[model samples]
Target: MNNEQRLLLLEKAKQFFRDEIVESHITRACAKAGKLSNYNVNPFLFKYLANFLKGNDDPRSIAEALVLPRVLGSSINTSFGMRIQKLISELFEGFGSTTPGIDIEFIDAIDGSKKYCQLKSGPNTINHDDVETIFGHFQGTINLGRTNNLNIGINDMIVGVIYGEEIELSSHYKRINERYPVIIGKSFWHRLTGKDDFYFELIDAVGDVALEVDGTKVLEETIDALSIEIEAKFS
Candidate 1:
């Protein structure tokens, strides 16, 4: 990528982190968390587990249980994943896709070929049903392309995982890769921007944005809310 394009991409990346990560961090992090009513607590299990505790007492363990997993769960992942699909579409100047399995159709920046990509946030994001859905959509697209006299081929189809290496991918992704090309991490970014260094550059931009944006207020509020629930139950 040229200097101008690099600058624009960096600006977009910063804005995305602000909106998706910083702005949504509050609600997204505590979506199913904070309030006791929001989660189903297994006091029996906690009691059993906390029985084995020495310095770590029951109340503290319960409090941690009430907050940690709920905050760390897939709420943020799902929202950020959806936003990533939109951002990637924009970055590639992609067209809105009519194909069911495809997110967007765009000219490959590096090779100048038409690419139909099914975008995922990470390697292990998909499951068995998703596997069926992707295959069904891909096959349907192929049949339609043939009928329409299009030049679409298996090589034109791509499964794009925004992060992770092939060896570390889950079974679902490995299965998908068996049928179609899987581009991920640096390779995925390189294909889009035609720069070997674009991946590292984007990572640097993400790090800079993280350093600039503050989410302490949201985090504090979430902790306060969770603490209230903990006190009510433990007191």
Candidate 2:
């Protein structure tokens, strides 16, 4: 990519952080607090006493456990995971595949060869089932390529992780890594755009955009509102 494409990609990442991460999380949190945060305290204490008795649990923690865990987890695992793929596609002028097992389809930055990548947000993102699923998907991609005479190699099918060291990979990912090339963190970002510092730059972009969107203020307000709601309803 040239200078223009690089700038555009940077802007897009910042936009995603502001709109998707900050704004969307705030909206969802407020909505959830409004809906289910009014549970009766008597029944809640009667029913949830066991959960909070031996642990240092309060209404805030209890609420987080009940509502915020799934909400935040889905935002990171599904939403951010998806946007990262889209940004990588934008960087390479390619697209993520709808084809099973191939989350990313692009030409390598340094080598300029087509790559089929199974993308993950973290080293430990997959389970045993995901390992097997990726293996099957890679095999399918290879077979499809061969049928079309595209000369796709096993090495062309890789697993790309957004943030982690190779040694930090979980057993499931390690198993997949044994069968296919696994690229992580700085190396993975470098593959998308032939720049070693791009990973740190991307992190900086997110952090900068977060502040620009008043992420701190909104998040604190959301937490305070949630804590108060939970205390009123369940304390």
Candidate 3:
């Protein structure tokens, strides 16, 4: 995209995020700034008002909407949080003994970013990459795991099934062709949250639900790349 097109897309995305997340904060800040401006507005400081407005209305929508996860690693251990676990349990209950549980050790929450809940178990070993791939098929048949106390976020995620299977590490690596990537599609996100907002959709991309990440490799990579772009722009 050209600079102009990029800027336009950014504005549209920004407006959408502002409408969803930060409108109240912006309004309050502007109100306070306006009050100060009306009083003894110092000449040098008056110029800052315009700059402040520019900062408030950032051109990148994703950037404006981006909410960072706490860098200090944490877990969701509340009663309401486990509701997600229950949801997962129900989702996978009919899927032939697929036990899904959340892994609190690696939970990360970021607005406008995919919230990943690391799920682990025996009999099936679904790793991070596998989880990313399975979530691609939200509309189709999926078996979500059963667990209680899943945390809620602007976007939410849950744990699915994990079972171990014998594998030739060398062969597996060769099959990946130097790209051990997990692909998730936009359709899957839409199925999860029914919205094009990337972050919100990603939050719900877990549980007993399983999508073929390998099958949707191209689209998944595209979506992930776009996510990276959005993150960088916002950062």
Best by TM-score: 1
Q: Across residues 99-137, which tens digit of lDDT does each residue of candidate 3 receive?
A: 233332122222344333433332223334653353442
TM-score-best of 1 and 2:
1
Q: Any runs in candidate 2 off by more than 4 Å, and if so which?
A: 33-78, 90-92, 215-235
Residue-pair clashes per prediction, in order, are: 0, 0, 35
Candidate 1: residue pairs that collide: none
Cα error of candidate 3 at position 9, Å: 1.0
Q: How many backbone clashes does candidate 3 have?
A: 35
* Candidate 1 residue-wise lDDT, 178-214, digit = tens: 9988888888888887888888888888889778856
Best candidate (score: lDDT): 1
| Sort order, TM-score high to low | 1, 2, 3
Of 2 and 3, the candidate ahead on lDDT is 2
Model 1 spans with C-alpha error above 4 angstroms: 47-54, 58-61
What are the models' TM-scores?
Answer: 0.87, 0.77, 0.18
